[model samples]
Target chain A: DQQVKQNSPSLSVQEGRISILNCDYTNSMFDYFLWYKKYPAEGPTFLISISSIKDKNEDGRFTVFLNKSAKHLSLHIVPSQPGDSAVYFCAASLDSWGKLQFGAGTQVVVTP
Target chain B: DVKVTQSSRYLVKRTGEKVFLECVQDMDHENMFWYRQDPGLGLRLIYFSYDVKMKEKGDIPEGYSVSREKKERFSLILESASTNQTSMYLCASSSVGFGTSGRNEQFFGPGTRLTVL
Candidate 1:
């Protein structure tokens, strides 16, 4: 059973616009949520993360919002640039062990 | 910078052949993991080791085993390669341990694309 899921497979956005990617998970034990970006033929790189104790966390153009009651999280990239085009994955973890559960990635395209 | 290196970037093997994928980390992390990424399935953990000579099976452990002989190395073994096992394999290491917060991000290798014929 897949505990983490990304309903959208792809998203296209205009440059400098806001791009939102959504994720849902069934596991309530997950407390740490993260977003990773992957380019073709490259490993996934950590983008941003949010803890269950907070509803939102931000870093530069990337921000992650977590809603524990709804078991949902969304990553938002404002002023999205062409360089943001890549596969985005949402991951969750239960504890401090660093083991993670990942969702099907959403491919984001930032068009000029 | 923390570095995680994989033994291969690409490998092609015949079905039923034994396969070995090795990973080495330079940061002396206490935890290492092996994961397979498939289209529309994301990344699935196969196995992980928290200490040398110790390992724990992840969600998908069937047909796979792991070894941790040294603190910085982890090996994933496929007893018999199968077509279904062809996928991009990733290795990651993190420095999360006792007395430290688990907020550490896992550093990943470039990944090895394994093709089982």
Candidate 2:
């Protein structure tokens, strides 16, 4: 069974628009979440993470929001750049376990 | 920078041949992991090591084995390679790992695409 799921397989946005990616999980035991961005022919790089205690965490251009009660999370990237186009993966883990369970991934394309 | 290096970026081998994929990390991390990536299946863990000579099997460990003789190096061995095993392999390391729960947030290598014919 897939513990994590990303319903959308792909997303396309024009330059300088908001790109939103969503993820859901079935395991209630999970309390920590992370997102990774991967380019073609390269490994997935860590993007951002949110603990279950917080509802949102924001970096410079990336923001991650979590709703523990709903078991849902979303990532928003504003003013998306061409370089932001890549496959994004959503992963989840329990607070104590170090292993990551990843979703299939969503391919983001920022067209100019 | 905590860099993880794999021995090869691409390789081809014949069926039934023994293959060795090497990985080394310079970060002095205590955790090392091997995972295989396929087109639609995403990345699946094969093996991981917490310390020297201590290894654990991940979700998919059939037909594969691993070794961690030293702190910086981990090796994956295919006793007899098969076409089904052809895919990209990734090695990762982290300084802290989840003890009973398993939490080393993984830092990965570039990856090796292995093909078996």
Candidate 3:
């Protein structure tokens, strides 16, 4: 069974628009959540993360919102640029030092 | 900067052949992980090691074995290659005090595309 899921396989947005990517999880034990962006022929790089205690965390143009009660999280990118096009993965972990459980991933396409 | 290097960018092996994939991390991290990435499966952990000579099985560990003789190097061995094992393999490393108060992010390698024919 998949503990974390990204139902949307892909998402597209125009430049300078807002792009939202959603993710859901079934495991309640997960206390930490992270988002990673991956480019073609390269590895997934760390984006932004939020602890269970926080509802939102932002980094530059990217923002991550967590809803523990709903077991859901969303990534918001404002003024999305063409360079933001890539695959996004959502991962959850019980402990900061433990292994992570990753979702299938959502491919984001930002058009110029 | 954390750097994780894999032995190869691509490899092709025949069935029943023994294949070895090597990974090296320059961050002196205590945690190392091996994962396989498929088109729709994202990334699945095959094995992980927290310390030298200590290993743990991840989500999928069948037909795979790992070795960590040194802190900087980790090896994944395929007892006998199979067609179904063809996929992209990724190596990642992170420090022990990851998360909470320390650097919990993992650094990944360029990845090795393995094809078993």
Candidate 4:
């Protein structure tokens, strides 16, 4: 069974707009949550992460909000650019060194 | 910057052939991982090693084996290639302790796309 799930397979947004991607997890033991971005033919790169102790974390134009009570997490991109078009994956881990459980991934497309 | 390199970016093999995927990390990281990314299935861990000569199976281990003779290199072996095994294989590495800002963020190599006929 998939512990992490991204119900939406794809999302499209206009440039200079806000893009939101949602993820849900079934495992409550997860303590660390992260978001990764992947381009075509390239490996995933870490974007941002939020610890279970914090409700929200932001870096530049990206922000990740975690709701532990709901077991849901969302990633938001402000002023979305065309370069932001890529696949976003949500991952959770029991600890910092433990293996990660990844969601199916959501494809984000920013149109002009 | 941490750099992970794979032996091949693309490979084609025939059925019944043995396949080997090699991964190397420039940084002196102790943990290495192998994952396969498939459409709709996302990325599934195949194997991981936290130290030299030690390995642990991930969610999927059938038809796959791993070798960690050195701290920087991790190898994945497929005894017999099958069509179902054709997919993009990824390698990642991270330090044993807390990574940047207390998160064990992994550094990934450009994936190897393996095609089995």
Candidate 5:
């Protein structure tokens, strides 16, 4: 069963605009959520994350909002740059657990 | 920087061949994992090791075996390679593994794409 799901396979947005990637999960036990960005020919890199305690976490232009009651989360990149164009994966895990359950990635393209 | 290095970038092998994919981590992390990436399946875990000589099976572990004799190295062995096993193999490591709720993020290596014909 796919516990974590990224419904959109691809997305396109203009540079200097906002890009929002959405993810949904079926398991309520997952206490931590993370977003990873991957470029071609490279492994994924960690971006931002949020815990169940908070509804939102922000770092610079990137923000992650979690709606634990809805079993959903979203990653928002404001003023998205061309460098942000890559496959974004949403992952969930229990806090302090090394094993992660990942969603199918969304390919985000930022146009100039 | 945390560097996870895979032993191979690409490999072509015939079916029935014994395959060994090696991964090395520089961060002295205690947790190492092996996963296979497919087109729509994203990343599927095959095996993970929390410490030397400790191992656990993940979602897709069939036809695969692992060895973690040393903390810095984790090896994935395909006992008999099959055509379906052809995919991008990724290795990751994390420093935190003791917590039951959550762990530190993992550092991934450039994947090794294997094709078994």
Candidate 6:
């Protein structure tokens, strides 16, 4: 069973526009959510994260909104840049012990 | 910066061969994990270690074994390689502190793509 799901396989947006990626989870035990961005042939880099207690967390141009009631979360990048083009993965964990469950990634393309 | 390194960037091996993939972390992290990435499947965990000489099986640990004799190294072993096992392998490490909620970001290595012929 897929505890976390990223239904959209790919997304495209214009540079200087906004890009939104969505994720859903079936497990209620997950209290932490994170987003990672990966480039070709490289490991994923951390982007943003949100706790279950908070509805939203922002880091510069990246913002993560969490809705515990809906069991969903989203990563929004405003004024997306060409450098933001990469695969984005949504992940969740039950506690702080380091075991994370990851969703199928979404390929984001920012066009000039 | 937290750095994770894998033994190989790409490898080709014949079926039934014993394959060993090595990973090392310079961050002295308490947690290390191994995962396999396949098209449309994303990353599937194979095993993880929270401390030296301790290991736990993850979602997909079948046909795989792991060793963590020292704190800095984690190894994945394939007793008998199979074509289906061909995939990109990733190693990640994280430090989990008390009351941290396990949200500590994991640093991953540039994956190893293994092809079983």
> DockQ of each model against the real complex?
0.71, 0.45, 0.61, 0.73, 0.58, 0.63
Model 2 gets an lDDT of 0.88
- Candidate 1 chain B: minimum summed lDDT over ten consecutive residues — where? B95-104
The most accurate candidate by lDDT is 4
Compare the candidates by DockQ and give the number of the best one: 4
lDDT of 6 by residue, A22-42 (tens): 999999999888898999899
For candidate 5, lDDT tens digit of each residue in A1-112? 8899999999999999999999999999898888989999899988887778889999999999999889999999998999999999999886464588999899999999
Between prediction 4 and prediction 5, the one with superior lDDT is 4
DockQ of 5: 0.58
i-RMS of candidate 2: 3.6
lDDT tens digits, residues B18-90, model 2?
9999999998988888989876666778998888999999889999999899999999999999999999999
- Scored against the true structure, residue A73 in model 5 reaches a CA lDDT of 98
Candidate 2 Cα outliers beyond 4 Å, as residue runs: A95-97, B97-104
Interface RMSD of each: 1.8, 3.6, 2.0, 1.2, 2.6, 2.0
- Candidate 6's C-alpha runs over 4 A off are B98-102
- lDDT tens digits by residue: candidate 3, A1-112: 7799999999989999999999999999998888989999898888988888889998899999999999999999998999999999998888655588889999999988
* Model 4, residue pairs in steric clash: none
lDDT of 4: 0.94
Q: lDDT by residue for model 4 over B17-113, one digit each (tens)?
A: 9999999999999899999999887899999999999999999999999999989999999999999999999999988777566767888999999
lDDT of 2 by residue, A1-112 (tens): 7788889989999999999999999999888888989998788888888878889999989999998888999999998999999999998877443567788899999999
What is the DockQ score, from 0 to 1, of model 4? 0.73
Worst 10 residues of 6 chain A by lDDT: A92-101
User: Tens digit of lDDT per residue, candidate 5, span B18-110?
Assistant: 999999999999999999988877888999998999999999999999999999999999999999999999999988743332347888999
Over 4 Å off in model 3, which ranges? B99-103
lDDT of 1 by residue, B1-117 (tens): 779999999999999999999999999899999999999999999999989999999999999999999999999999999999999999999887532333888889999999998
The CAPRI classification for model 4 reads as: medium
Residue A60 error, candidate 5, Å? 0.7
